[model samples]
Target: MGLTDTPPPHVPSWVVPASGALLITGAISWDMCYVLMSIRSHRTKSYGMPLLALALNLSWELIYAARVAEHPLERLGFLVWLLLDVPLVYTTLKNAKHEWRHSPLVAENIGAVLTAMVALGCAANYAVADWWLSAPGTGFGDKSGKWWAGREGFDCTELAFWTAGLAQLALGTGCLAMLLVRGHSGGTSYAIWFCRALGTLTGWIGSTSLLWWYWPEAHGFFVNPMGIFLMTTCLACDTAYPFTLAVVRRSERVLSDGRLVSGISVKQSAAPIVKKRL
Candidate 1:
């Protein structure tokens, strides 16, 4: 999303420009991460993104591209991400059963389950977007320049903040959850982890912090109790993920067909401790 309005005079000139640069950096890094996920998905015989994260992100992209997004470039970014996500979604649908074998209810009807997820995700995102855009001074129309014009909705920046934060939370936590559930790093790799961590750092934490510092009035929620919690939680999870991944990757076996055997590398793993007879 574009700034609540291009930085005003009181704010240091470098701040907005720097924020813009960080925003672009964040976007490019995330785009690269998405591509890497698709590539890793094909190689690993498992979906690249975690199920819940994928659903949340894809839903956000879908709605933002069609409804919430305003600026031409902002809309374009969401659109590109949405289009790029199609393959990732398909890959998940195709391979999800394998990942969910332990839960027959899930594995047996993954299609239905995913369908419900997208549907619910869409409804929830749409509700919030509509609420922001339609309340009194805001009322739905093209969101471009609405806030900057001193009309209403404050560029929908708050909406973008919360949604983006939610997506990051789902993804950050979902990655580790998948690792634990699958007991391996089937769709995960060091590069994927790096890009993801970097994306959040620059995307939400980095860019957000920059803008909030520059325009505290418009971006106060960046310091909201919920916002602080969301960002902190995501950072903590991402920080711990890679080390766990390293240990798990070593123990996980890979099948010849590119399938992952359960993670259990006894040979390369640490020797187990045995208790001496008491």
Candidate 2:
């Protein structure tokens, strides 16, 4: 079957609007979080999003946004995300020097490193998209078969959803780790954490619902051991993040100059925690 020739799956009336709401709300919340983070980074010169996360997100938006053109609403959503990412990317690249300020060598070579990261990220995203397109049940086999014609495999949508979920989970985990290590919320805030957590929850629900409705045979992927474990881990991390921030804030002191100081005195500490603009 060709990609466009596949019949649309039968879905119940309510599932469409419910899934749409989840997906749309999740996307908008995430975009707002990124925008807020970018604004904070600009003023504080401290970028919040992890480098790997930024690269992966940018690449995912670029590739999938174009590839899903047949689905007008989904394509438009991706395009909106892509547009929002531009400013965040620019802010990250522009203020990266501050992140590497302590390491002169890294600061000097940051641009080259960022360039390489973007290139590598794009390559990785392409690889995932290719894998999805070539997977067994996506109706792209007629096209994919030209290369590896007869191999048996899993569903494309399952693989793609899993890939994106894992990437988002990793991003959230990495941000949590950074906050813990720094002992202060610099470029991160409660708002970012809250939105990210809620967004991930809704996105997960939305993706799973859509897949279940469209590809009933693939529903097992959600309840399988690996899937359950991954989802649980993501939820655990995201849910705990805000409380963690609150606990850490108890030890934080706002200085006269507006810099945030963690447990240690500013005079004795080598690095003072700069307050992120709310």
Candidate 3:
């Protein structure tokens, strides 16, 4: 069983964690909406693709919330998220294709595929975790698929976890590399860089925890705690991204208007010449 299979050992005051998680989730969802609105206001109607991608992710989160309750509604919601992912991934790929036309970050585009795959694969992992959590006497060390051991159905679930974790690490690294290489005004900010670094570090280390869990030496006990820590870090990273973007935009405006040019060099401050006079 994965780390998420088990609930918190010490259930805190019922209101605190539940309310906090729900509130934070809601706020993050709102942040996505704000991102969408900002894109719409700043860019042309071409932002439809990003809005669609945002919607797809939000749908997945909705399904996730419902799934925890084991209601039939969860299945339908997840199905919708799955369907939406197809087009969303397509749009993201199309955007990357456009980006690759001018940028040499082909590897980063490939990493985008990995990101989408990992994001979607979490569903199957949750299913595995749920089954394991429901079973009895399945001690912490039990990696045996009790619910899935003898089933005639093929089990791609464990494979999903492995694939997702690897993809996540690759994507994080690819993104960091792209940021270092490209460092556009949007990309150069300390907040965005720091958040990406933290996210990548947590993801890489978390993958190691999963590796240890799969290995013969230690059991799965450490995996869950480490994974929870990593996930919370990721959630923090995602939550911070929008605010970082907002700050970047403001800074860009300041720089463009020549209102804040204290430390930059003459070359750094100079805009590129688009044409040369005859």
Query: Which candidate leads the pack in TM-score?
Result: 1
What TM-score does model 1 achieve against the real structure?
0.87
What is candidate 2's TM-score against the reference? Answer: 0.77
Record all residue pairs in model 2 with backbone atoms less than 3 Å apart, i.e. clashing.
none
Top model by lDDT, which number?
A: 1
What is candidate 3's lDDT per residue for 137-206, written digit by digit as tens? Answer: 4334434332333332222223323333333434333433443332223213444344334433433333
Query: How many residue pairs clash (N, CA or C atoms closer than 3 angstroms) in each of the candidate models, in the order given?
Result: 3, 0, 1
Whole-model lDDT, model 1:
0.77
> Residue 16 error for model 2, in Å?
3.4
Per-candidate alpha-carbon RMSD to the true structure: 6.4, 7.9, 10.7
- On residues 1-278, what C-alpha lDDT tens digit does candidate 1 reach at each position? 65445555677878756775677677778888888888888788898687778888989988988886666667778877887888788778777877878798998888888888988999999998877776533422233333633455455666777888998999998898777667777777888888888888886788768877767765677888999999999999888998988877877888888877566533765878889998
- Give lDDT tens digits, candidate 2, residues 1-278: 01222223454555545655777788788878887887766655567887777777777677666653345566777778888877787877676675566677767776677668767877887787686665455432222211122343433445555767767867878888866765666667888888777778776655565646554553557766777777888888887788888977888755554444466454576888899999
Q: How close is candidate 3 to the true structure, as a TM-score?
A: 0.38
Q: Ranking by lDDT, best first?
A: 1, 2, 3
- The residue-level lDDT of candidate 2 at 144 comes to 22
Off by over 4 Å in 1: 136-153, 265-278
